[model samples]
Target: MLIGTVGNEPYQRVSSDNGPYEGAMLGAAIGAGGAGAGIFGARMHYKGIDNRAKRHISAIESREPVIQRKINKVNEQAENPRMSFIQKAKSKIADSGINQINNLRTAQLDSLNSKNEQLRNVVDSMQHTNPNVANEADLSRRSHYAQSYADINSHYDDVIQGSRFSKMKQQVDQSMEHKQARIEKNRDVKVSRLNKELEKLSDGRHKWGEDGVKLMKQKHPYAHVKGIGRSAAAIGAGALIGGGAGMILGGLTDEVNKHVKQ
Candidate 1:
């Protein structure tokens, strides 16, 4: 029969066949076994949580240097000039060439207009039997000349719009912008991830409290003392209960045997 409780909870039982001393010993053994199982389970639970926290911390430490190096490299690239002096000079030369070509096209158009005017004057001074033919020929020449003038001007406008230096400047600016954006994105992402990991591991709790092993000890204090204390208390209680129940049972059994004999 179960004889006693630890903390108001029954934990030990004794067999009916056992003598008083034997019953007491069996009850005590059962109590101790139960306490031991409880202690083991508690220890494992605490250890699992602590180990998970430690693994997370270790992972963060190992990855920090690699992440920092990548951050530095990106920062350096963002800060440095994209174009060298040679490249700048080349862009300038290309821009100058474009300007020269635009000027040449303007001069050629002016020359064509002047030559056309002179030919028109010569045609007007000559006598023509068909005046309408002459008029139609002059109109056709004027149309062709206007078309040529418009085409040259359009080409010049295109060249000016696509200036090499301007294009290069825009490209360099865009490249720098992209690099800076990348640096910021990388830093934010890594820092946010690390912070979240630390938060989870620390259970949203930490402080700049101690250093080295002391820090670790503070964070995860030993449970040995508490466990030992509980085990000792349990054993002591079991032994006390077992001894009292054993004496009572022994007296009752003797009384029952004597009654049976009579």
Candidate 2:
């Protein structure tokens, strides 16, 4: 049995021997065990949240390089211009025309060479068979073939350097330049957009990491403290209930023994 006082008021005797002390010790042990389990669970939960956030951040960061590569590819393509279909067709036509002109020049030159060779043979025969006739013959006429060859070459040059051919070539070049300019402009816009997206992603990753750290710092400790508080409350409640029950049982036993003795 035990007796105590609270605030100048004398409390009733607790009939069970060591009832309050044993119950309190038992309740505290149980509460501590429960608190430890709750703490472990809370810690695991916090760790899981942190790890999940980190994984999400890592995933976002991985996409950063992929987007950057796309930007680089776009820029590279912009640097190297591609001819349009129309321009390519025009160029092919121009080349064909030039080939035809060259073929004609070659045929004319070959014919002139054949005629010149026949004249040379005649001159050689005259010089060997009749020296007087060879001297009297207008040998300067042989130079006409060389002049004709030069004229054919000049005509070829004139056709190649003609205004029509030059204009066609210039148009093709201008078209390609225009196409390249458009590509470069589009690449600039696209690259700018991608760069902005990368910036946003970088910011998001940073914020996510910071928020995860902040959340863990703020919530984990609070959760642990809350669990501890609940366990403390459980201990107090269990002790109070157990001690009251033990005292009641002890008083009943004392009364029963007394009656048996009587």
Candidate 3:
């Protein structure tokens, strides 16, 4: 009985020692697996943050050029007088659906205004500097200049479409053309009659040739009126025709080449 009990005691102790060893090995394996998973998760998180920062930097670099270009354009505009003039004129003469015409008008007005201001300022400065220059003769000359300025301004007032001023100017021009034509036609008829009368007066004058025959009765001023009347009539008719031709050309030029495109 004593030998059997000692044998049983060694077997029980062996079983107890085997349980603790197996448990320790399993616990070590679980700890190693958890540590590896945490390391992988931390690496993934840091890499995602790095990629996001790179994309943000790239986006900022792309937009920087557009912003810089606008700033440069503004700086150029601030320094340029011609550009400022164009902008001012454009504000005055803009319209829908006609950018080219508006730009042309802006340029034209800019040039015209700049020239006018320069001339005006020079005159003002001269008068201010030399009081002696403002004598009677000088004042008369200045008055004449002012009259010339008024005449030029009267010729080309800004007559926008759909305005009463435009309608009035058009009507006045038409009336002037009609009246001038009538005067020209009447003068032509009068000249033709005078030429016929001269031929009758110098019918038998041997001293006067065909061309000079109109001057036959030079001494008889009261007795014959042919030469003088005929010559005056011819000159008047020539003047009328020349003026009419000039008027036609001027009208055509005005229509084809407008001062203001808009």
Candidate 1: segments with Cα more than 4 A from true spot:
1-24, 34-64, 77-165, 168-172, 175-179, 194-234, 238-262
- Name the lDDT of candidate 2: 0.69
Each model's lDDT: 0.60, 0.69, 0.45
Tens digits of per-residue lDDT for model 1, 64-138? 566667656665665663555666666667567766877888798989899789868765755266677778778
Q: Using alpha carbons, what is the TM-score of model 1?
A: 0.35
What TM-score do all the candidates reach, one by one? 0.35, 0.46, 0.22
Local accuracy of candidate 2 as per-residue lDDT tens digits, 1-262: 2222211111113333333444344444444555566566666776677677788798897999899899989988999877778888888887777788789889989998898888777777888789877766636546787689889999998987784656687788888888899999999999999999999988778666877567656766535456556756654665565555444444554454456579
Instruction: Quote the positional error of residue 227 for candidate 1 in Å.
Output: 13
Task: Order the numbered candidates by lDDT, best leading.
Answer: 2, 1, 3
Better of 1 and 3 by lDDT: 1
What are the runs in model 2 whose C-alpha is more than 4 Å off?
1-47, 99-158, 208-227, 230-262
- lDDT by residue (16-89, candidate 3, tens digit) is 34443332333333344444454445445544543554454455455556555654554454343232354434
Q: List the residue pairs that clash in candidate 2.
A: none
